[model samples]
Target chain A: MTAPSAPLVFLPGPTALHPRVALETRAALADGFLSESHRSPRFRACLVAMEEALRSLLEIPQDHRILIVGSATEAMERIIEGTVTRRSAHLLNGAFARRLRDVAVNLGREVVEATVPDGQGFPGSPDRFRDPGVDRLLDGAELLAMTQNETSTGVRIPPDLIHALADRAREHGALSVVDLVTGWPSEAVDPARMDCGFFSVQKGFGLPAGLGILVVSPAFVERARERQARGQVTGGYMGIPALAQVADRHETRATPNMLAIRLLAAVAEDYARQGREALDGAVRRRAAVFWNAVVDLPGLTPLVEAGPSRSRTILVVEVAGGSGPLRDRLARRGLLVGDGYGPGKGRHLRVANFPVQTDPMLERLLEGLRNEV
Target chain B: MTAPSAPLVFLPGPTALHPRVALETRAALADGFLSESHRSPRFRACLVAMEEALRSLLEIPQDHRILIVGSATEAMERIIEGTVTRRSAHLLNGAFARRLRDVAVNLGREVVEATVPDGQGFPGSPDRFRDPGVDRLLDGAELLAMTQNETSTGVRIPPDLIHALADRAREHGALSVVDLVTGWPSEAVDPARMDCGFFSVQKGFGLPAGLGILVVSPAFVERARERQARGQVTGGYMGIPALAQVADRHETRATPNMLAIRLLAAVAEDYARQGREALDGAVRRRAAVFWNAVVDLPGLTPLVEAGPSRSRTILVVEVAGGSGPLRDRLARRGLLVGDGYGPGKGRHLRVANFPVQTDPMLERLLEGLRNEV
Candidate 1:
């Protein structure tokens, strides 16, 4: 019952995986990458390189522990479930934000959802977190979880607001766990400055899906150790301790999607060689190209107001007059975009503008959408 | 800083990923597997095929619910943590068996361990499950857990004993969860009658390492739902409900390693067209071919006693007289076998004889082992 092969063009994160990276992945798999001892100097070297590459990309200091996991969702759930030993507040602005809250609640943690409109992103100030309900909610809370870039909606939560909240949460002895699933070097958030930050590999690193990169402060590691001591340790195949052990060996614990990991390293190298500033410039340029094109399309309305607050990797577009058939028409023409998530579902589509959002590809997609509409 | 590609040959359980699978995986990545909806008929069809193929391979009833997850470990943990609401007795004869026990205990279940020598294989009597300690442990216990095939030490637990243990646990109002990480068509057991059975795609189906196939009985599923209603659901990426929903879809919830899934379907089709008896016979024949060749090799001793009770898919060899680098010598000959895990660590090397354990491959490995010794 497995489906036959189908040709697809991506308007999603990191678009098509880089061809060279893909080639390296195939070569590594063909050459038998999994059999190597994870602790071998070569594997450990890969781990060190991966950590350094990501550290440089995130503009983080060397002391932060970087563990690469299977996906952003895995890291998000692990951090929330593993680090949050008691009650916590989850700041929700979009679908992924709500997913974080759900993860906390599912883990049997006491969770209070701090709400915001989907398209509005997170509120611009920390005043919203100062309410009596919020204070009561924070009474026994041990963590404040939020998302930096809500990929479900084209909204970006400002890092300053995040830092502000982190400071407040700290006053109540709570840690901050951020789901920067699509934010990283492109947006220039320093991981060392935050308690814990995570992002998806496919979105920011211009690689294939399957790998997630997480940066945790040493404090988070101590908390994890405490959880382990309390016999509350949950084994995520991608759990941070397991990941750290594997990362220390510069290898994955299980046979990773070797193809994806290899491609990720190659993509990281490509970024490093080009320099972070150059990569950031490329991302900004690509986002501008795709966003501008989507704005000009007759049947589509930009989902976010023009400002620095908007996501640089995803462009949310509302089909003019809420036409589902029009969206389907664009999809049929090989312009695959994400359906709006959460409250915006059925009325919006998300177009990714990460590093893989090439000028030519975006132009072609825009032309196709126009012609189809 | 990706490491240089080495020419290491994996004895392959985490076997050398097939080049064809890797090729298709690259194709999947380029074509966008993640961007597709899970509920789509295309993915659902894949799920159905995978489940059917698994049932056919294991000779299980159509009524048994089949679920696929990231790895065999995830499935094992879910089954143990989900069903066993109280205490449990764990039968430990190998590394993976102990891991199952660890998972159960870590989830707040009281675990009573039943011990056996690492290389001796499972005891012959069901009375072992009726031990006073085991009986006492089952007072408030919700299940008895054990591994079918001890992949680490090449010991296959006796099915009658396992069935007896399951019956005893059920008599005490408990369930039975089996970590059949290596058990497959090597022997026959009716999964419909068992509470839960788990396996990884790599060992038996000869697929990549990413997909784990889990089959469960109606009794266990009902108990899990009851627990969920009580808000006592244990959370993990491998939670039973989430896995069940994906299982119901016959699709993986997260972006599956698509190329591997597709390859698994193709491999399953190969086995199906060839018939179960033929495939099982082939696996048995391959095991004999290697076992016979190694039975008299100089300085090599069969770790397990010779009989049908031994795991046909894995042959554990102990160095004769004393341990003096026999495993290292074989590896030098490009024959990659597993180091004895846990108690057997360093004393034995495990050679797997799964579906991919082809005649030529065995002949070459044996010839190399013979020459080296």
Candidate 2:
């Protein structure tokens, strides 16, 4: 069977973009997405198609605002700049969570940190309402933010905990924003229970890295509108209200990565035909193949405790020989696994099973590791 | 010769993209540009290739800073936001120039407007510049900005008048920034004499859009650094110093539209091998052929007067029967030209004859116009 083309598989993020994406991009370059007005009827049709597809896939409230922009980082920063006028508590456990703190700090927001040692899940049970540390920070804060999936360490803070957390924030008059870059259906976090959430198109959506999808609560958008009127613009690209205005007309403010959208439309159509449970089942099945292989390897140990609560799309492992030499050897053999992100250096290696990680591909990755480790 | 492919030509702004542009984009989709570091050796190599090629083709100064960004508008906005503070005088005759005023006004900078009625070249002499109307606008303005070719109305401002205007601005301690999107070498305006200039990949380059090339005078960059240190952080993807930092690396700040860059590299190589004069000659010759065939046709009149000062790449024609009916007629005949831009509505139609325009393509445009007009 053509020796199974040397799997140049991606680790979830910067996922494999569909071929249609390129076809449309080529068309866009020739047709010039910006050649027509963003308000044009044809342009509006494109936005409406994507928005409707997104609403069905994510099970988000139809009333929630969807603002597309440059990156998830830009969306997170905008959320901070718009919703949090006073101090806010930032929950940290992995690289993406730390990124939230960094963006908040850059935007001149007063950030209070909630600490969790690496390789650990969110404190205790999902039902546990509040962390004393988070509570102290949220005393006079305007918002509470966290990452639903710490892709760095392969941990998923249970959705029940997130609902409790969001409930607490509401009691304190603070909004809650979540970075769900890799979580989504795997954890089955009901969007009806969250205030806001965002993800980069590269991850779960299987599109290119340039576009970000944001789900902003309508109440928060009201706050963003007020912030915008005051001339307090957070980002050049992620002007929420500006994007909403364009989106209201069924369009995007900038010439969107139309190629990416076309591919997304194709995938969304496929998912709709198959059903969410079927897609989720496929991801789980792929995860199982990888999980079984990792447990069998003598020199490899699963980094995060494997369970339904942990990331089903990502598998973090601690290599017996350590990160430096092992990663180098794997690269020489032409298999690129994720390096330990941020502060998780040398001790951790991440493997992401997202979008279309087939059983054969997972087997190949494990076989490559078995020979090396 | 396969019926010469029907000349499927339009204004080069929406010109057909080379198939390779799409092929490369499809290849890159598997691992999007953001998957790698902007500072990585590979991306650096891409930048070096583009910069070296652009430098040779444009005849730009080695010491000048040339940056690649998302779009031509981004480049235009960057130049103004980076170089001009407090106030700037904008010479407006078409849509593009008016947009510059909008950008300046959006940035909270005071803008002095110097306007000539649409569809007219800068008055026969220098009287317009020395008039009380323009003099009042120039007072205390930090920079003078204008378009090299007002493609909307097919008016090309004389570079000597521009040089004189820049010289005048310099006397008043102001700089000159120009947008040469469709005007590159088809009309000569040495960037070596201006403080800043901007263009895009699509029109004159005969490549796809999505890439903006900005050339900054060394003096302009130095002044920008001084202003940035004073905490003047402008919004938009074109935050000057941030953009310049990425440019300093000779790489893009965000994941670049790599396919566009590869296509642009091919274009630059073709131009370099053919030499600038040959490229410019081809454009002028085609413009001559198209204009010669249609200029005297009934219900059509040239927008810009015939002279060396006219844009060699574009021929703007006022639809003597009014824009609507003529625009519709051309479209029905299977030829598309740009409709009036900004204030030029119902007054003009634009025919672009840039690098991509060929003699045979010119014939098809005339044939279509002949049947309609």
Q: Pick the candidate with the highest TM-score.
A: 1
What lDDT score goes with residue A177 in model 1? 84
Clash pairs, candidate 1, are B12-B15, B47-B250, B313-B353
lDDT of 1: 0.68
**Residue B29 alpha-carbon offset, candidate 1, angstroms:** 5.3
Among the numbered candidates, top DockQ falls to 1
Q: Please write out the lDDT profile of model 2 over residues B229-259, one tens digit for every residue.
A: 7755442233566667777777765555555
Q: lDDT by residue for model 1 over A43-120, one digit each (tens)?
A: 556656666666665666766777755567667667875677777788787888887787777777778777878777
**Model 1 bad stretches (over 4 Å):** A1-8, A13-15, A35-45, A125-139, A230-255, B1-12, B18-23, B26-41, B125-137, B236-238, B321-324
RMSD of each: 4.0, 4.1
lDDT of 1 by residue, B1-373 (tens): 1123332343426654433455556565555554455444665676577667766767777667877565776676667656767777777787788777876766667777778878776655777657777778677777777787888888887667677878888888888888777776455655865788887767666555556667887787888778878987656454676767666656665555544566676676667666767766787888778778877777788888887558877778887654437767866666777766666667777777776566766777777787877
Q: Where is the poorest 10-residue window by lDDT in model 1 chain B? A: B1-10
